[model samples]
Target: MDWQTTKKDFKRYLEFERNLSGNSVHAYLNDVRKLEVYCEDLNLEIEKLTAQHIQHFLLWINEFALSPFTQARLLSGLKTFFNFLQIEYDLTANPCELIETPRLTRKMPSVLNIEEIDSLINAIDLSKPEGMRNKAIIEVLYGCGLRVSELINLKISNLFLDVEFIKVEGKGNKERLIPVGQQAIKYLKIYMDDIRVHQSIKSGKEDFVFLNRRGSPLSRVMVFIIVKDLAQKIGLQKEISPHTFRHSFASHLVEGGADLRAVQDMLGHESITTTEIYTHIDKDYLQSVITQFHPRS
Candidate 1:
């Protein structure tokens, strides 16, 4: 198959069959582009690619000083491509079978302390029209541990506020019901009753929970900007994003002794191991828990 045509088919497979997010699809395509460039430089077509060519391409990317994590990530995309070609297109042989991914170290995610969380939340200007909505946005971000995309796409119909839970549509279009904290529910109600009810919502966006001044749904970038502005208002020095609140939510829950499997379900993680990355407990807290609870102590 030709390079462009094969790549197009691969993208369709990722979108339709795999149900990967747009960003994920783009990343895989970017990896394929790198391989394409390498082959073009050697006057070799996609059909002519061999295991040696794939190895040399890996070497070329390694020379750029990319970290092991990035290399492994890129190799994952390549593996997906070759697998698709083999299974779907009935390609003869897959060169990626023998290729090995680099070992990756599990790095801890940055989380905000309770004091910092309150400070950031309190920093929001409550007098503005979008004030209540932004406050609710932060609350929901932390409360439900939602991704930015999930937050933006949140629907009013999915909210089960009466039952104290909200149905979250997460990655891969998976839906899970997450318990909402009282504070999140409170601000969300205020935003809905006071601001959202008064605004003339855009036709298609009427279902979205959070909306902008124009009554259209908030974008992912707007959510990032909201988080950044709040952090700056509180003079928080640590680098953080919307996802930081999600990490903080998971970390706080784990620290409070929430069940691992429960947290995994709330976060909509495909694996419990994915949820484990958010856990970061301090030594003092552990010692205190042991000292208070142990009979010998």
Candidate 2:
């Protein structure tokens, strides 16, 4: 079968059987496309892609400037795709089975201190119509450690402010209930009642918690733009994005001596290895403890 046909089948398998999100499906497909690009670079035919071909591909990827973490994820996606093709289409035996992933070194992510977070929050212009909505968005982003997509998809119905919780649909279509902070709840209520309520919401976006000026669901890019603009407004020196809130959420908890397992559960991380990055962030706080308590101090 043509690789295109096989690729379409793989996509269907991911969506129907694996129940992968569109973003995840696209990422997996992109990994496969990398192999195609490599083949074209070498002036080789797609049908000629075999285990030996994949071995060369892996070696080529290693030579690139990409990080081992990103390379490993791409390799994992390739492994899944080939396995799916082998089982369903009876293609040439899976070519990526025996390949090894590069050793990944976990790096600590940057976090905003409480004061920095406060500065960013206060920087929002409250006089404008979108200002209240923006304030609520920032509060919820940091308060819940939400992914940009999660924040955009957040529905009014899923809010449980009375119970101090909110339902978040995370990666892989997994849903989890996270505790809501009092400050976030306060702003969210104000925006809902005073701002979002007055907006002329389009039919489809009525349930969406955050909306654009036209009352449509906010895009992920808009979230990024808002964060970037805020960072600039506050003269924040650190490179930050929507994901920085997630990093800070975990880092702050770890620094406060929260259990690693509990932080992992709240973040909805599938593996403890992914959660271990925050433990590294706590090392600085650990040093402070040592300095304050040690007889050497």
Candidate 3:
């Protein structure tokens, strides 16, 4: 099959069969496109590819000095694509079967201390109409440990505020109930009642919990800008993003003796290993505590 046709089928598989998010589907497709370009340069066909060609592609990408993490991700995407070809097209053998992924060092995420988090939130100018909305956004982000994608797509209909829980659609369109802190619930109500109710919401956007002043849903970049502005206002030295609040949320929970599995559930992580990163954060916290409090020289 032509590379373009194969890509279309792969996109459908990623979107429908695998139920990946739009961003994830886009990233995987981009990875395949890179390989497609490499193949085209050599006049190679899809079915004609073998492990040596795939290795050559990896070596070729290496010439561009892509980061190991990115290299690993590209290899993973190709592996997944080849696996799909094996299943759907009855390919005799997957070309990427013997490929080894590049090793990556997992960088620990930056986390905000309770004081820093408070400082960031307290820096908001509440006189503006959007102030309360921004407050609610930060609260929900930290309080629920939501990914920015989940935060932006959060729906008002999913908010069971009376019960102090909100349902969010996580990766792969999986839904989960996350308990909302009273602080988050309070700010959410204020934003909804005071700020959101007065907006001229665009048609088809009414159910969205967060919105721009124009009444459309907040874009992901807008959320990042919000977090960055807050950090600057507080003169915080650490560079961070909306995801940092999520890391802080989990780190704080683990430091307070919350179970790892529960943290995984709240964060909507598919695997416990993904959540275990916080345990490393927890260990760092312990080290600091001992360094500060221990009497030994």
Candidate 4:
């Protein structure tokens, strides 16, 4: 198949079969474009591309100093593309099968301490019309460790604050119930009663929990900007955003001796291994504890 036609089919497969959103579909397509560029540089047609070609392209990307995260995503896209080809076009062989994805090192996420979180939250001016809704946004982001996409798509119908749980549709359209903290429920109630109740919500966004100034749904970028502005207002030196709160939420739970499996369920992590990355053990703290308590000493 020609690159253009194959790409078009890939889009349909991603949307219909994979059920990915527009942005996610575009991201996968962008990864394919990288392969197309590599093929062009080598003067090879799309059909002539082999597993070895894909491997070389990956090596070239690493040689060009692409970050491991980006490399990993591109590799994932390639794998998906080849899988689709095998299923649809009777192309039995997959190129990405033997391509080893780069190992991603888990870095500890930047998190605000309790005092810093309070300062950031208090910095929001409640005098504005969107103030109450913004308050709810941050409260839920930190309180539930929700992804930005999940936060924006949160529906009023899904909130079960009385039971301390909220239903979230995460990656691969998988639904999971996450516990909602009490403080978040308090802010949510206030926002729903005061600001969200009075707004003349647009037709399509009526069920959406967080609304823009025009009574519509808030975009993911808008949420990022809100977090950034709050960080600046509080003079937080560490770079912070909405997801930082989530990382902090998971990290804090792990650090406080919460059960790893329970934390995994709360964070909606697909695997226990993924949740294990959030367990940040301090070497120096361990040494101090041992020095103070060991009977041998």
Please report the candidate that would top TM-score against the real structure. 3
Candidate 2 lDDT by residue in tens digits, 71-125: 8999899889878877886767777778888887666677898999999989999
Error of 1 at 58 (Å): 1.1
RMSD of 3: 1.3
TM-score of 3: 0.96
Task: State in Å the error of residue 202, model 3.
Answer: 1.7
Candidate that beats the other on lDDT, 1 or 2, i.e. the better one? 1
- Alpha-carbon runs more than 4 Å astray in model 4: 41-43, 59-65, 281-297
lDDT of 1 by residue, 1-297 (tens): 778889999999999999988888999999999888888888997766778888899999889999999899888898889889988778888887788888887777788989999999889898888888889999999999999999999999999999999998888788899999899999999999988999998888889999888989888899999999998888899999999999889888988888999999999999998987755444445777899999999
Compute each candidate's TM-score over C-alphas: 0.91, 0.89, 0.96, 0.86
Ranking 3 against 4 by TM-score, winner = 3
TM-score of candidate 1 against the unseen true structure: 0.91
Which pairs of residues have clashing backbones in candidate 2? none
Top-lDDT candidate index: 3
How far does residue 231 in candidate 2 sit from its true spot (Å)? Answer: 1.7
TM-score-better candidate, 2 vs 4: 2
Backbone clash pairs for candidate 4 read none
lDDT of candidate 3 over 168-195, digit per residue (tens): 9999999999999999999999999988
